[model samples]
Target: MIRFDRVSKRYPPGLDALSDLSFEVAEREMAIVSGHSGAGKSTLLKLIAAVEKPTGGAVLVGGQNVGGLARSALPYLRRRIGMVFQDQKLLFDRSVFENVLLPLSIAGFPPRDAAQRVRAALDKVGLATREKALPIMLSGGEQQRLAIARAVVGRPNLLLADEPTAHLDRDTAADVARIFHQFHDVGVTILIATYAGELFPGARRLRLDHGKLMA
Candidate 1:
């Protein structure tokens, strides 16, 4: 679960990314954040993930104050959350399986268990047959699926995606949205920041405008 109380984020000398935003996302809930470019959607996601601290107010994830968390506790916090970016950030030199395996390896999971989880994650994203292939060899949609597999391999409790379908065609975007729906069905808290709301139906909508939440 996530809770933000009167949160604000100001960067550099005077740029206000978010101002007095407040919201709560319950466990096992799915929500879609929609806004124009530079509306602070990305910044809001970063606050939840602890990638950026709020300049004022408080951010709580699973009951811990993200802004007050010690540096040493960051890894533990991040382990409970999975994130996907618009760019897909896949390593061109690594095989699909390796990319998916990286998170497990970092968490020190046993090799056999990690292998099983990796394959399962790949299958979840419809990439089981392409595990041995490099990222550069896949189509845009396939690459994005691979990224999703990598993010979910650790079985994170919270899933956050920023502009997940920004580059895909309508059909492919639907495919990606279905993948997210699958995860949500199994009880993962899902929050996606997207410019296209039609891609996600039945999700609670949160809109922002010029750094302010639009009620």
Candidate 2:
């Protein structure tokens, strides 16, 4: 769950990314954030992930104030969060399996356990057959699915996606949206920042404009 109370983020030279933003996302709930470029969508996600500190007020995830979290405790906090970015951020030189295995490796899971988790994640994203393939060899849609697999391989409780379907065609975007729904059905709290929010019908909508929440 995420809660923000009058949160404001201002960079040097007085640029405000978010101003007095307040919202709450309950456990196991799915919500979509819509905004234009420079509308603070990504900044909102970064605040929840503890990647950026707020200039005022607070950001709390799972009941702990993220801004108050110690640097030493960040890894622990992040272990409960899964993030997918628009860029996919894949390493072309690595195989799909290796890419999905990075997080588990960082968390020190045993080799055999991590291998099992990697395969399960691939299977969930319909990429089990491509585990040995390179990211460059896949289609855009497949590459995005691989990124999703990598994010969920750790079985995070909260999933945050920033423009997950930004580059795909309508059908592919729908496919990606279904994948997110599958995870949500299984109790993963999901918050997606997207310009193509029509893909997520019936979900709670949060719109931001010029760093402020819109009514």
Candidate 3:
């Protein structure tokens, strides 16, 4: 569903974040991006999300060139992709349900429909009972699950997670991976950027080194 053709991005201060990175992620395929620090894995994810544009080449999603999308269309493109991060990125002030509903709210979905979707997403992430809780009140794993719920509440076609299991314990990391797999089983394309190979043994591994992909 996503392809990068000879893409490269270099910052102004002479730092090359990514170099000649080309890869394709098929629909419904779950893959892990593996690399050490400064290996360009996070840079790749940012490019896919359009948080930053490429300095060269193209980033194609479902045949549309995201690199060339109009500014007015960027939000629509991002709504089709869900992203989770190591920090969870939850708002301390909002209830879990409210946090999950932010995307729907931004899209101007009606209140009732947005609430229903939020509840469903929470249920999918096994956090149905925790909807009214605050982020500061939940455990680390629960907070991470909340992040996943927020990401998938939009029913995105592609899910990108960066260091998703970084702060969790072994069993919790395994649980989170299983949750991601469940999303994959039902047809969401999953691409995870992680350094923990042992945590994702069955996933297709794409190794990155020094801003370049390695075999």
Candidate 4:
């Protein structure tokens, strides 16, 4: 559901984050973008999310060109895609339930339906009981799970994760990996950007070096 056609992102002063990067991620397929630090993996994710636009060529999602999407339409585009980052980025003052409900709330979902979906998302992430607790009270692993819950609470069509398991012990890292697989199993198209072989042990690998995608 994602297509990058000769996409390149350039910053000021002779720096290119990605150059001529091209790939297609079919609907419902889970793929990992593996690379070392400063290798453009995060840039790719940002391009797909429309947080940043390609300086050349196009970024297409579900057949719509996102490279030049108007600022007014960004929220609409974001609603269809969920993103999880290394840091949970949770609001410490809000209850976990409220944080998960934020997306639905922004979309104008009714309170009753929003609560139901929030609970379901928390359950999916194995954080049902912690819904009433603040983020600071949770462990790093639990905080990450809470982030996952927030990302998927809207049943988004695409999920983009960046270094989701960067923190935590091996077991908790495995738990995060399992959660990604579960989302994939349920037909959510997921693109995860992480270090080589970090979370996706058996999945197909796409290596990014410097700024170019290589086989």
Candidate 5:
């Protein structure tokens, strides 16, 4: 569950990334945010994740005000949310299994349980057989699946994906979309910011223009 109330984000030199934005995403729902470049899609996700704070109004996640969250509390907040960033941000030098395992290790999950969860995540993304391979060894779509596996290994409640299918061919993108649909079917709230929104025809649509919500 995420709610934004009159939120505005002003960067250095007073550039407004989002202006007077207000929206709500209910639990267990999937939504697609569509806009051209510079429409604040990424910034909106950053606000929910507490990587950036709004200059005005508030961003609330699961009823906790993210804008006012203490730095000490950020890790706790993030544990319940999974993010697939635009760049994929993989640990290229690490094995695929290690990349998926890193978050559990950091969160202090027990070794045995973490290992099981890592394997399950890979299976969900259809990457079970490639766990020992380095990221560089995978194809583009497989790498994207690897990123999704890493994001969900912790069983997060909310999944935020920024441009997940941007690089893939249509069929591969559709395959990736099916993976996300599987997670959503199991009750993970999904929010995707994408240029290829036709992949998610049934998701609630939120369009933006020039940093503001559009009708």
Candidate 6:
């Protein structure tokens, strides 16, 4: 569902975040992007999501060229892809349900439909009972689960998570991993950027070093 054809991304200071990176993650496939800090894993995911454009080459999602898309067309493209950011990016002022509902609302989903979708997403992440709870009130792991719920509530065909399991107890990380496993079983294309490749052992690996794919 995602293809990077000779992609390169360079920052303002001539930092090459990704250099001629080429790879494909097929529809419904699970893959892990492994690399150390400054290895460009996050930039790769951003390119796929069209949050950042490539400096060169093409990023294709579902066969559509991401870099070539018009700004007005991005929302429709992004609706099919979910992202769980490294910071979780939850709104502390909102309740869990509201957080999950935000994406659908932004997409102009009807109020009734959005609420239903939000409830289902929370259930999937095992957070239904806590739907009314504020993000600040949740434990760290629960907060992480909340982020996952929000990402999937849009019913995205592809899910991209940046360091989903970082900074948590083993059991909590295991819990987060289990949630992703369920998503994979149901045929969501999954790509995760993480240092912990062992967390997703069955996933195919794409190793990056200094902005280049490692052999």
lDDT of 2 by residue, 1-215 (tens): 89999999999999999999999999999999999999999999999999999999999999999999999999988888999987989989999999999999999999999999999999999999999999999999999999999999999999999999998999999999999999999999999999988998867899999999998
Model 2 earns a TM-score of 0.98
- lDDT for each of the candidates? 0.93, 0.95, 0.91, 0.91, 0.95, 0.94
Model 2 per-residue lDDT at 184 = 94
Worst 10 residues of 3 by lDDT: 195-204
Kindly report which residue pairs in candidate 1 clash with one another: none
What residue runs in model 5 are displaced by over 4 Å at the alpha carbon? none
Measured with C-alpha atoms, the lDDT of residue 134 in candidate 5 is: 98
- In candidate 6, the residue pairs with backbone N, CA or C atoms under 3 Å apart (3 or more residues apart, or in different chains) clash, namely none
The regions of model 4 sitting more than 4 angstroms off are: 196-198
TM-score of each: 0.99, 0.98, 0.97, 0.97, 0.99, 0.98
Q: Provide the RMSD of all predictions against the true structure, rounded to 1 decimal.
A: 0.7, 0.7, 1.0, 1.0, 0.6, 0.8
**Candidate 4 lDDT over residue span 1-215, tens digit each:** 99999999998997999999899999999899988899999899999989998999899999999978999998999999998976767888999999999999999999999999999999999999999999999998899899999999999999999888886888998898999999998999999898736567656678899899998
Minimum summed lDDT over a 10-residue window in model 6 is located at 195-204
- In terms of lDDT, which candidate is stronger, 4 or 6? 6
How many residue pairs clash (N, CA or C atoms closer than 3 angstroms) in each of the candidate models, in the order given? 0, 0, 0, 0, 0, 0
lDDT of 1: 0.93
* lDDT of candidate 3 at residue 190, scale 0 to 100: 91
Worst 10-residue stretch by lDDT in candidate 1? 79-88
**Tens-digit per-residue lDDT, 70-186, candidate 1:** 888888898889989878889899999999999899899999999999999999999999999999999999999998998899999999999999889999999999999999999
Residue-level lDDT tens digits of model 3 in 99-160? 99999998899999999999999998889999999989999888999999999999999999
**Tens digit of per-residue lDDT, candidate 5, span 110-211:** 999999999999999999999999999999999999999999999999999999999899999999999999999999999999999899978999998888
lDDT of 4: 0.91
